[model samples]
Target: MHMSVANVVIIFSIFSSAEPYSGQPHIVFFVVDDLGWNDVGYHNSYIKTPTIDMLAKSGVRLNNYYVASHCVPSRNMLISGRHVIDIGLQHGEIGYYPRGLPLDEFTIADKLKEIGYATHLIGKWHCGCYSNHSLPHNRGFDTFFGYLGSSDDHYTHIIMSNGLADLRLNDECVGYKYFGDYSTIMYANEAKNIIAQHDENKPLFLMLAFSAVHKPIQVPDVYMQYYKSTIHDNERRTYAGMASCVDEAIANITEALENKGMLKNSVIVLTTDNGGGSVGNNWPLRGRKNSHWEGGVRGVAFVYSDLLPMDVRGTENSELMHITDWFPTLVKLGGGNPCERKNLYGVDQWEMIRGMEPSARGEVLIALDTTRKASEEYRTGPFKYDKFDITTFAAIKMGKWKLLTGDSTYRNFWDMPDPEYGVIDDEDFDDTRMVRLYDLVDDPSERTDVSEERQDIVHEMLAKLDGYEKAAVPPQMQTKPRLDNHVLECMGPWID
Candidate 1:
């Protein structure tokens, strides 16, 4: 159920200092890159994700969770609790741009560290690593053992785009030692080591952002063999193996937590950075990554914690949630005042997750890409102007209505390669509508458009978009750096 913006004023009760575990639970947040909505066993897909499915069944499933359409934008929001437009990163992913997330904004790790939590980050740090100042080690993580780039070759730990080693231990490059080790296993081993060496007294905040199921589909032969008989297509089978490896990594990490006696008070979360990629499947959800559709922004996520009330455990939460909400939610769970700082787009969803009240959030700005330009002139419905020419790609959800303007990059109904789940596109499918509206409450798959019938809602949402646009900042511009000898060999910060 969706709440109106007017209903968002409901006040939240701060957890008392006298609460259990001193009200600061250990947080284990796992971010899986481009995990498909239907890839997990719980979603009834052919992919094997036993650990993820079991944990989800024993926890709270986030049915209406949303994130950005791509990597950098979602990571930016998740870290800062701020929208991408406000931070000038709404355009696209950061490549060799030599730009990072604005350092001025306090990260989730920074906030938790203020309250005595030991923050650790393992795996992908794609928010940017162009400069020493923007590295994860400087961004409030006490320890960072991971890659600094978007993706890498699973075994070699080398970014194929630039052919540079990407693994690091804190600020030092350590890729040479991990050669030939599959990233999923390597990162899991790192997580286990951290847990084993952790101080039991302090609350631990661990963010395991895996680079699995993203690109360069590579997995160990053992993992690949598990899916060989069931998954016929080679690419699909390899993708399944990668996902399965992630599941195994999670299982290993969970076992370590249990062994450390930290599982009892830990809040373990699983979320995708974005929707599935090409080889991945987000069946019946309307589009893939890099689009403004539900399949692109809606995440596959869940929260597993012993702190949740018994009755609410293993239930589905349909309340609206965005990637930004985690910043404040985790801070609150760590016994810190999430309201101490102001202007965060995220709300404290701890209460909502605990099954106490409805979601405090009423609206979600799915995406706003001012950089998106029309490839050709197009018009449809009552929009008389050159809507495509003037419009910026944007989508917003308020209550039951979701509005879209400008170009939606990829618009297709994608399914698994398996013949059973394949969808046949109808002849009437229109991909040219520059302006579209859907009642997401009634049409979660985004099958029909109601823009013509609901001009009043369209105008209201357009005004909202205008307000956001006026307040939005331009994307940061940075020159591409020359690949010197040192830069070509290592993927650490190139700038001081």
Candidate 2:
């Protein structure tokens, strides 16, 4: 059945105390799929995101934010506040039931609901997408009204693997569910409905993780036309349209909250799981979705609430943050201290959001993989140490000196020519992924290497990395049954 993609506003609001920062307010999170640091309007990208731009303009922009280099690890880390190895998925591949985030691990929803908040998940629940056993309904969420896997066919809602429907409401198995509904629009409507029907007496936590700009980049025609003129490549244009749709959905969600007078107390978290993928724009950064380069982990992030100190509003924050930080921060915001738990790897940064401290976070443990044998990375202050399985990609940085021990794929990573646009030469393909060093501050483009000139700094940075590599979590070798190509393609690559 085809349904008009209209803005369906459900007029129910969970009545809450209007007082500013009174206890817990509504929490709406929009974690878009594969949205790059340079994708949004606020980043001066051609892609139009008036809503996102306005949100950044009115909210706090996290200029130095980061996420995992890919989806599965990012989502797992974000939800569990545990590193992938501790959670049993070291690399960014693995999304299915049983293999998903372990039930034992506490989630943000679990924390919020414990403190009298009604939690709901209304989009891609990629953490796990199998039987009802591992779905959001079984998780901390009071309600789950989205897909079980990653990117579903936006219109058909088909998971495409096993060629079955992927859409769901609560827990019933999807069978061509919500036919003809543009997923971006459908997800937005669902979010608005949840906001309306929410019991305002308790705070609301809605995780609206949109499958925007993800692969199989399907978007509605009306949306596609909006970006055709600006985006040249047909594939990229389609991707841009999808991103545009997600931006619109965010705007509508905020509007619905505003209409109910819930915007005042709501703290809306806007971010993406990882860097841009296939058609995503990560220009000026090094690599794409899969690489651990800054392009993959640096995400477009922000937090907005009317209650946020007005002075900090629209201002850029330099405090380093990770996707996992939100888990503890939101818990603290809900009047509970998640960081108090010894098991959690996340720290509470609610004070940073309040502009009370310059940074509670000192270093970032981005990833430690034993997947393709053993490569890890840690970012402390201005320095980032990256040790990759491939000898050609090892790197360490301190201040302006970036020491790369392998052939750096800085330029050739995004070498694929778009379908609409013809091929381009590989600028970074110097035949060998060899040792190269570049000062990021001076050459944000990563075009030069000064490894020999800064041998002293390289030695110190390598020594610092020696400690991190030794302490890095080893990859877990647990494996589970595989699903159809369609299903596993989007989820994390499973390992047993």
Q: TM-score for each prediction?
A: 0.91, 0.83
Q: Write the per-residue lDDT of candidate 2 for residues 1-496, one digit (tens) a residue.
A: 1222232222112222234667677899888989876788777557677777777877799977778878888998898777675676665454443467776677888888888889898878777654445667777898887776766777777766555566777756553557888878888998888888876667888999887778778887777797766767677788878887887888778777877777777898988898887578776576778766677877889987867887787799877777788888888878876854546767788789879886666556566553443223312212333343334234443444555543345434532222244324456455343345566668765556565577566556656545655655554434665555554322323333
Judged by lDDT against the true structure, how good is candidate 2? 0.69
Candidate 2 root-mean-square deviation in Å: 5.9
Which regions of candidate 2 fall more than 4 Å away from where they truly are? 1-19, 95-98, 129-133, 373-439, 455-474, 478-496
lDDT of residue 196 for candidate 2: 84
In candidate 1, what are the lDDT values of residues 153-185, reduced to their tens digit?
989999887788889998778999999988888
For candidate 2, report its TM-score.
Answer: 0.83
Compared with the true structure, all predictions reach lDDT values of: 0.81, 0.69
- Estimate candidate 1's alpha-carbon lDDT, on a 0 to 1 scale: 0.81
